[model samples]
Target: MTEQPARWTEATVYPDMWADPDDDPRNSEGPSPDGELGSLQDYLTNYRLTLRMKCEGLDAEQLARRSVPPSTMSLLGLVRHLAEVERHWRTWLTEDEPLPKLYGKRDADFDGAVAEPAVVEASFRDLEREQAATDAALAGYADLGERVGKDGVAIRELLVHRIEEYARHCGHADLLRECVDGRVGQ
Candidate 1:
């Protein structure tokens, strides 16, 4: 029988090194912000940082590797999905009228995740750009209680949802990374 290939490679090692939650740059300083922005903002920032840290140092194949059989999730897919989610909440939810979805095929992010260096780089870049846009939009709103979505979601609710979404996905990422290589932490 053929030996199973190692999911993680050298490149994956470095990125993971940089973001180990125990040693993350953001964590090195004392405690994070307190009530400056409120609980929701703090939570969102924490989750966002967690997601980026989880993806740090992983290579294309490692990022694209699914956790196990019957599951299509991948770190790359998570990044792309989060990017879409951020865009949707920041733009669509904030708009006076509903806007078209960013992705035509709902599952394209997952289906398209691949073990290609270029694809992985593009996915990360897209995530960064989308996150920046979302941050800018959020900064424009002074009131978290302001209603934004047609479904009656307030800005605060959407922000909290984004944090929860990232936190959940980061947990998945942690497991996937551990399965790929024996290295595990944060």
Candidate 2:
């Protein structure tokens, strides 16, 4: 096992989601950029990393374990679901041609998530790909207020929604991971 720094403690510093900012690998020391878009993207980035961090050091079975009972949600499921969410949002933001969903039916991402090694590997890989693609699509737009598509969705709205979506799921992840192995942190 790796030796942890002595400063690490379970005590909460404040009413923040992160229990220990100094020990958190995902904590950013720099201030948010001087714009709404920058701020939104910054939060989104943190949540994305939080999701990945929550799943760290787990085997395929644990990753896919239905940690939350009575609900098909699993860490692996969240990864797959977020991947599809990213893809769908990218299409909406970029007005790109519609792509078929990762899993055909509703909630299929969670339903299909199983304790298979291959599936766990693929889930993480898909998430990374989808997030990168979505980031690329968002890069094309500078004006957060600019609206796109027939529905006329604002870029800022979508960006904020992405952060909100990840934040909600990351909370779920906190419980799920703790249930699995008592591991908890930022």
Candidate 3:
């Protein structure tokens, strides 16, 4: 019987990861934003890119692979969930009437993350579209201190919260990617 080969990307570099650190695409090199808003945006941008990088070079099945039993936190699910999050935030900030939830209800984003190419492509598209829309909405606010949404949450707080959410999810992405193919890095 023939053994199955590992599902890994080509050009593995280091034990943890093959790609050179300096050449890593996730590096948003150069001076970071000095002001609070710039700083928040920078962090958010990097986290978003990091998540996408982690999911790269993977097929639909790998993207939708669940972490452990009873948990449906797949890479594809994360993308979909974040899309819903971005859409929700943008709606809250821009509209007097909140639009309907993207995935309908809680956890549907994860639950519906089946291993299908169309689904995977749609997840990425939705995430990117929502992220752009959210950023555009954020740009309208000159001051982070200014509040938005029905709950009256400040833009500063919302940006920070989004960064925090991405940070947490990126950590999860690292673990999930490692488990999927033994490839690991920041």
Candidate 1 — what's its lDDT?
0.72
Task: Please give the lDDT score for candidate 2.
Answer: 0.82
lDDT of 3 by residue, 72-143 (tens): 999999999999998888766854887677777889999999999999998889998899988888888988
Model 1 C-alpha lDDT per residue in residues 16-109, reported as the tens digit of each score: 4533445565454566566635666767777777677677777888888886768888888898888778777765464375444444478778
Tell me the TM-score of model 2.
Answer: 0.85
lDDT of 2 by residue, 1-92 (tens): 53432332253774334456666767767765777777787788889888988887889888888865699999999999999999899777
Best by TM-score: 3
Q: Of the candidates numbered 1 and 3, which has the greater TM-score value? A: 3
TM-score for each prediction?
0.79, 0.85, 0.88
How many clashing residue pairs are found in candidate 3?
3
* Candidate 3 lDDT score relative to the true structure: 0.83
Question: How would the candidate models be sorted by TM-score, starting from the highest?
Answer: 3, 2, 1
What root-mean-square deviation over C-alphas does model 2 reach? 5.4
